[model samples]
Target: MITERKIDLTGLKCPMPIVQLAKLIKELDAGEEFTATADDPAFCLDVESWCNKTGHELIRLEDSNERLVAVIRKKISEVE
Candidate 1:
């Protein structure tokens, strides 16, 4: 079964949101999904880049109400 998780980074600034995301990702198992929500304008770009660099799958990204949400699936190879 796939596990789902959530991390709220709203109101946080650059680097911190990404930093916290990195930490959260590290604790997840392969095939799990996590949604990270943030208010930082740069979160979308930063997270897209981060996911690309780290080999995570960017499942979906939603931008609305001055908030940014990224749903990511943990890559099987990256779980270690």
Candidate 2:
């Protein structure tokens, strides 16, 4: 079974949300997924780009009313 850790950044801006995600994701083990909620539209692309650059997996990007939900998987290894 897989468990998800949810982080809400509803009122946060672009870099802050992504920056917070970077720190939070570092605390999670590999294979674990994190769901980040934000109201900043830029976060969708920013988060995706950040994950791509860092080699973490982007599982999903969805919109729920006023919030954008980004699901990211922590990389299994840091050897990249």
Candidate 3:
């Protein structure tokens, strides 16, 4: 069984995937895991860099199997 929060950006372009991801990230609580699938070829590297720059943890990056799917986990930060 596939147990993960899936965000599909299969028909999106560059920047859109990241935009969508950013929106989702903001709504995600700490310790939540999100898997995003994007058709944008540059998204693989873009999101990776974005994650690194933003301090979000990237669990895995599978870019060339069947689609561009990035596994990301939120950091521990208590929200008010």
Candidate 4:
């Protein structure tokens, strides 16, 4: 079963939003998903890059009003 979560980073700036996201993602089980909302103008690009680098799926990204919303799915862990 996949679990969904949401995080609000609207008032944060720069790396704080990404930092908080990373922290939350750590707590989620593999295949779980989350939606994050932020007001920082750089959030869109930052989220895209973060997902790519972290191997998570960036399912959707869009702007609503003045806020940026991102949907992401956690990647399954690989055994080394």
Candidate 5:
């Protein structure tokens, strides 16, 4: 079964949200998903770029209330 984790990054500044996201992604198994909520205005763009650069999938991104919410799926492990 696929697992989904939730992370709250509200009030965090630029980079911190992405930093926390990266840390959480590292701990997730391949194909697992995470939903992160942040108040940083840059989070929307940052997460998109991060996913593109890292091969992860940005499944959904939206603004709710005063927060930016993103759902990301962990990338499959690369063969060595």
Candidate 6:
């Protein structure tokens, strides 16, 4: 079974949101998906770059209300 996780980092400044998101991603099992919300203007770019660099899949990312919402899927292997 797959479990969904959530990380809300709204109102946080740059880097903190991405830092926390990365930490949460590390704790998840392969195939697990998580939803993260952040209001930092740089979150969208930071997250996209991070995911691309780390191999995690960015399932969805969008702006809603005053926040940036992201849905990410953990990669099965770190080296893959």
For all predictions, the C-alpha RMSD in Å is 1.9, 1.5, 3.3, 1.5, 1.6, 1.3
Per-residue lDDT of candidate 3, residues 1-80 (tens digit): 33568899998987788888889988888778999888788888898898887778999999786588889988777334
Model 3, position 23, has a per-residue lDDT of 92
Q: After superposition, how far is residue 22 of candidate 6 from its true place, in Å?
A: 1.7
TM-score, per-candidate, Cα-based:
0.91, 0.88, 0.84, 0.91, 0.89, 0.91
**Which candidate do you rate higher for lDDT, 4 or 6?**
4
Model 2: CA > 4 A from native: none
Inter-residue clash pairs, candidate 2: none
Compared with the true structure, all predictions reach lDDT values of: 0.90, 0.86, 0.84, 0.92, 0.88, 0.88
Q: In terms of lDDT, which candidate is strongest? A: 4
lDDT of 1 by residue, 1-80 (tens): 66568999998998899899889988999878999999999998999999989999999999998899999998988444
Q: Candidate 2, TM-score vs. the true structure?
A: 0.88
Compose the digit string of candidate 5's lDDT tens values, residues 1-80.
76569999998998788889888888899989889989888888899999988889999999877689899998888534
Ranking by lDDT: 4, 1, 6, 5, 2, 3
**What's the lDDT for residue 7 in model 1?**
97
**What residue runs in model 5 are displaced by over 4 Å at the alpha carbon?**
none
Worst lDDT run of 10 residues, candidate 6, spans 18-27
Clashes in predicted model 1:
0
| Candidate that beats the other on TM-score, 1 or 4, i.e. the better one | 1
- Name the candidate that leads on TM-score: 1
**Any idea what lDDT model 5 has?**
0.88
